[model samples]
Target chain A: MAPQGQVTSVPDDGLTTRQRRNRPLVIVHTGEMKGKSTAAFGLALRGWNQGWPIGVFQFVKSARWKVGEENALRALGEVHERTGQGAPVDWFKMGSGWSWTQRGPLDDHAAAAAEGWERIKADLAAQTYGLLVLDEFTYVIEWGWVDVEDVVATLAARPGFQHVVITGRRAHPRLVAAADLVVEMTKVKHPMDAGQKGQRGIEW
Target chain B: MAPQGQVTSVPDDGLTTRQRRNRPLVIVHTGEMKGKSTAAFGLALRGWNQGWPIGVFQFVKSARWKVGEENALRALGEVHERTGQGAPVDWFKMGSGWSWTQRGPLDDHAAAAAEGWERIKADLAAQTYGLLVLDEFTYVIEWGWVDVEDVVATLAARPGFQHVVITGRRAHPRLVAAADLVVEMTKVKHPMDAGQKGQRGIEW
Candidate 1:
């Protein structure tokens, strides 16, 4: 496959690999297909393996979703704590519940989204993690819970060598514009498209 | 955050979650975007946590490119072999080198691809792994070395409840049609677009 080059008004700076590694980046993953969060989680796993502090902040995922990547990452954290080799990690779910009846039980998705965004902002300010995954965060912009400009500004001005990864579909134009790296997942075929339901262990 | 149901004509089977767990799956990650192999590695890690045997077949990755995930997974494999916990893993890079100067270095990319496919087929027939990741397999099909139809048929009939994940770009249509799941990554921005090459422990 061939990905088109970066598109938009703000262009990426011509930084060498060493300089680039030292610079913080805002990476975005938005798409209509699966793997956005999965890919982001993969990146987090890579970062953790490199001994970088990692943080995963889920904005709108169902609280009960309990993804397999989450379990694996948490296990990695435990392994690190037990043996001083893995990266320190943290995972947070600010979204509501899963289940057919209790889907997003929160009365105000907007408020919850705002709260999630605010906390992430604080983390960015403190540069608490070298690699921070804002899992499913595009939902906040998609649902109008957070302003795109604020996100772009915050990410643009974030301190330290922190690398932030945002994941979800329908990322705002401004967010895409501000990102240093962006990936849009396009679906070609999926099991559910064939009437298959999500499976455990693999799905969660 | 949420994947809308499948949109293609291939409807997923009405397999119960338990049944799905018991059935083998053929998943593909293809596109121009980054993370195709990364996501596949993450899945392997999750499966390893569940004590499933994992195998990674690298078809066309540069011989010198030893990804961080490989290191991490191999370490996990070592841990398992010593303590009898995590899943056993085997990593193979069959297809020759990368670079215009040393492309394949084997005179015949097609023959090398075929040989690689043949070995994987033997492994599948032997049910050598529960979670087999055919990393960069699409390159073989893309290069017309192996028949997509044959590849698809082999996976469709593979033995055991083994899950196979093929990752690369430009997946063939027949391959996509035969896949249980497919993700096409679209690049919005890349570090290389900014003249920043892949960094050690990050891109590799």
Candidate 2:
């Protein structure tokens, strides 16, 4: 967190500073606390400022829920289109036609999650985005909807300079191992702990 | 982090859910890791989307450091000006003419920090912003440049619906006690631990 951006340790990875700096990263935001997805979206904001194309795929949350980041980031995309200031942004969520195939039950969240993973795999293969945010993706892995090994391997071998950030609670060990940076958002205190209900603007 | 935004516990405070939900919050982001400020800026993005005017005050970091959020948020302000979207944004940092009233040494950071805090007090009293981000302000409090008791008292008794978010490592105990929500960004694993250098787009 230093202003100079100091590295804590220099590895024997044999890569030059520039090479190490430019290397693509896999970041994981996990733990049972708030700000996991929020921090990932904040990174997307930073990536957007760098003119990096951002792709956000919400694995768990339904499209019906109107999160504030969705509107703000989509608005930023419009600004990019109009003023050519930031880069383009794409947002996708589950329960929004991922059930088009109608495989078995209408509440087949597992199947829908698998479909989302396939899309992410395709995007990774195509190198379609500079930053790919898999918001709440750990749930899919935790629920056995998606294979953690597959997710980690695909991200490790992802082509180009695509940086992927996964956010959710109880992240798989393999995913954490594969991540370059991992932050566990720990709750010291929450309004909910004091019996306060979540607000529209603040929580959403 | 539920889609339904369910409260873990309901208080017996006699307030309706609507009133409790409408209450303003004081959030503190503290720990020995990255994304403290980034998560705060993410909240600012949500606030801006809610049409809440945002005021950012940088306490420790100098004005010369070009962080990405500053540009993105300022661009968002421009978008608001052009298209009548979001809300107004204002950003301030230290070492940028708070020295104009120096009474002692040229490197009197304590005086500068105190002056920066005075402006915040004035803004809070005037109810100038719906969201005020005191970025890295905890450092000043940690260094005893500003009194923590005064800060807690002022924020606890601040007028109107102003929500304040303070971000830094090692937040004061009194401030944390006063906050409605507190998140400690714990580092599970860092690229720096493996000797990876910080990158331009990723770090800043």
Candidate 3:
């Protein structure tokens, strides 16, 4: 029923245009104590299964010892074993310069944290991974330790194939505008206020 | 040099104690689009202002549409206008669902659309919302329409002080999980892929 010179053949099997062009950048806004880090861990595990290289960046106020980050790393190990993707890369923790235990001016400590953010920026610029997770990086901006504009620029400049996931509370409107996906984890209730201290395997 | 046994009476802030005692329930997940109804909208906005009468339940497929909810509702003046509250009451969305126009079975439509999750759960219980925002309720649970235990339980058993949010993607999960808030919307993506088209403002 086609014209004499018209080509009426369908494209080859197992390939589609949408799949070829679908590259996503996800932003997750985890409100206070709603397990944003845990969700990131789940995504990392899934990415590892697909043989995607991943980078983890933790930028928070006074990062000393967070059990959630540790659990995420341990989960990465399990993912590695399941997928045979070799060992997972260790996370880079960019602290707020001053230790939580020591309460002082912390000018020098703040400088170190700034340097760590630079390192993260550089890694993102280099485009070294299929997925990158920026954990609690929003707090750095909130505390005036990092420039939100610079972060936005870096994300905008990323290569098309790279997928970036940023997590934190109180994300800026600018960041939300730049993101392809955003999830805000609002906390309705928490157990800590009811005379219950942070419990292992739950709060951590 | 204070006098012995001089009792410094502390003013009892009743808000904190009440908040702790009530302990609002929160449910977070991904579901179909455009499933949450006006009831969910009213509760989320009103309960947030009152304090301690809030819950966030999202049932969307991917974590993409949350920003859309914020923008649309805020533009429509649904969200509370003031500040200084300990935490804001707002509905959050999560997840990406399948494209409707794709060449799939029509049987997947209801599940993909999340038809019944929002109303059945949120409205039936009637107690879950001081405020509720069901971000995406339909599409997430479209595959299994008949089996929705969690939805029933949550709707049937939620506490009086709780507000609910229900977004639509697939309602199967939502139906089993119960919702005090429900929303549903048609989806239209950017740049308009072949066989896909969208109007300005409506799609965005």
- Chain A TM-score across all models, in listed order: 0.82, 0.86, 0.74
- Which ranges in model 3 have alpha carbons more than 4 Å from their true place? A1-20, A24-26, A30-33, A61-69, A72-83, A96-109, A192-195, B1-204
lDDT of 3 at B171: 47
Listed per model in order, the count of residue pairs whose N, CA or C atoms clash below 3 Å is 7, 1, 69
> Residue by residue across A90-137, what tens digits does model 3's lDDT show?
465544332322444435645655776677666667766766777777
- lDDT string for model 1 (B53-85, tens) is 888877774755446677667767766776776
lDDT of 3: 0.48
TM-score on alpha carbons, each prediction: 0.80, 0.88, 0.47
Query: Distance (Å) between predicted and true CA of B9, model 3?
Result: 22
- Pairs of residues clashing in candidate 1: A1-B169, A1-B170, A193-B6, A194-B11, A194-B12, A195-B12, B67-B204
> What's the alpha carbon RMSD for model 2?
6.1
| B33-76 per-residue lDDT for model 3 (tens digits) | 22123223323323333443344444434423334334323322
lDDT of 2 at B189: 98
Candidate topping lDDT: 2
Give the 10-residue window scoring lowest on summed lDDT in candidate 2 chain B.
B97-106
Chain B, per-candidate TM-score: 0.82, 0.86, 0.40
DockQ values of all predictions:
0.43, 0.64, 0.04
Q: Using DockQ as the measure, which candidate wins?
A: 2
